[model samples]
Target: MENRIQLSFTVDKSLLLREAISQYGISKKALTSIKFEGGQIIVNGEEKTVRHILEKGDIVTIVFPKEKKSEGLIAEEMCFPILFEDEHLLVISKKSGMSTIPSREHPNGTLANGIAGYLEKNSSVSTVHIVTRLDKDTSGIVCIAKHRHAHHLMSEMQKAGSIFRTYEAIVHGSVEQDSFLIDAPIGRKDTSIIERRIDPEGKQAKTSVEVIKRFTVNGENLTHVRLKLFTGRTHQIRVHMMSVGHPLIGDDLYGGSLAIMPRQALHAKQLKLVHPFTKQALTIEDEYPMDIAAVLEKATIDK
Candidate 1:
């Protein structure tokens, strides 16, 4: 419920809090939020402001107050895997087959439903607010805010590029290049209500991809790719990969053959962001599931 993080540094040279924060790679946004949030910056057992100068061997401790959870959401009893959880945010490790929130058909059995069940016991959280979403078949990290203020803060951070999201996938073919950028416009498909594709008039979308590994399986070529999302869009990864002629292995809707897995072979692997209230830099990673791990195992090294 309560968390404390201390970033201790030995001053090789004298410095102020600003210089030390820069040297230590601390979040400046976090330092500024101390006025609003219930946190303290302690230096050598004494509380001090950021303007205080530091000498050698100063131990700094940051105290993060436990956040107040809200109420009103009806909780569902599903045991969704939690990657990281605190008062401010909950990072969920979503399964490949689960939806983040409810649709007309999937009104229940969703991540939101599970979160509601979780908050029911805590008695502090109000409505469920999902900060990030994953496609039903794409498994990985999804962030949820405990309250509305946290939601607004995270959304602004995402627009400013402070909140970073990354994913990994097994695509249909070997990539000729080790790394490349897919800078394309994405728009909704005319035929499908949920499907998206490359369109000249659509909003700008960019995905930076790096090949982690490449191999052949049953004479079929596949590449393991890590992609960084610059802009979040519906079916961005699935659509972009298809445009490049290498859709995800099991993404049938996006020109991919469904032979290995039943769902798209994409994982939300990493998420990085600054804390909305505490100002800490946060990183969450989901463990590779056995389904994807099995694919990695069968892949023969492609030289």
Candidate 2:
């Protein structure tokens, strides 16, 4: 069934087209298609560009086309190990190979879906909110807030650098320096795709790494390194490590070889942030993933 939302507020005349589409929750493609079909989106009793500005008492009418629900979209329930839970927030350790949210290919078995199911099953908890995200193949501690207000507060804290995050990674080469910093800019390699890369004109990205251990594996030097991200960007650690000539082991996308593991050898080892409700500092740590442990063990034996 198609649904229509009527707007009663006047929009600023200077708003951009993309911003309008985002506010309406309509796809840019869909909006363009509607205009191409003619007479679909009637603004103030006439069709207009997505970039058209508005004034006081300007009526906006949007017709949403019916979308068929995919039969493949299956929602499932799974048990998520709760590391900490309180009135305002919950923290959990997410396993590698598990997605943080539902997607077209993975309609279920995601951390978000599982958490939704868990909250439904437990009546004591109310208002589920995700404050931050972790990559599917990157195992780590994640924080979720229980209310919108708390979510905003925690998100602000993260953006302000008050929240600290640390990760452990096994890379392909031995880091010659005891500790170093990678300060590079990252931007989309292609605007059409979501892939990101180092761009001098891109946003600022910084990471500090310290070598914890180093040994030989299959005649190649490997190092266990700890990374602290001063700025969070997509694939920041993986890309920054690669930029420094020591891509993470098993990270094929970033120049790692298949001889190592199957995914990036990175794990979120510690998280520190202030609790939203109590305003008290909270710090949590997680053990290294088994695959990384196994790699370390191999390096130890070879040494």
Q: After superposition, how far is residue 223 of candidate 2 from its true place, in Å?
A: 0.7
What lDDT is reached at residue 192 by model 1? 84
Candidate 2 accuracy as TM-score: 0.73
TM-score of each: 0.76, 0.73
Q: Scored by CA lDDT, what does every candidate get?
A: 0.81, 0.75
- How far residue 62's Cα lies from its native spot in candidate 1, in Å, is 20
Error of 1 at 151 (Å): 0.6
Residue 297, model 1: Cα distance from true site in angstroms: 1.3
Query: Which number leads on TM-score?
Result: 1
lDDT of 1 by residue, 99-185 (tens): 887867667788888988787666753468799999888998999987554666687788888889999999998898999999999
lDDT of 1: 0.81
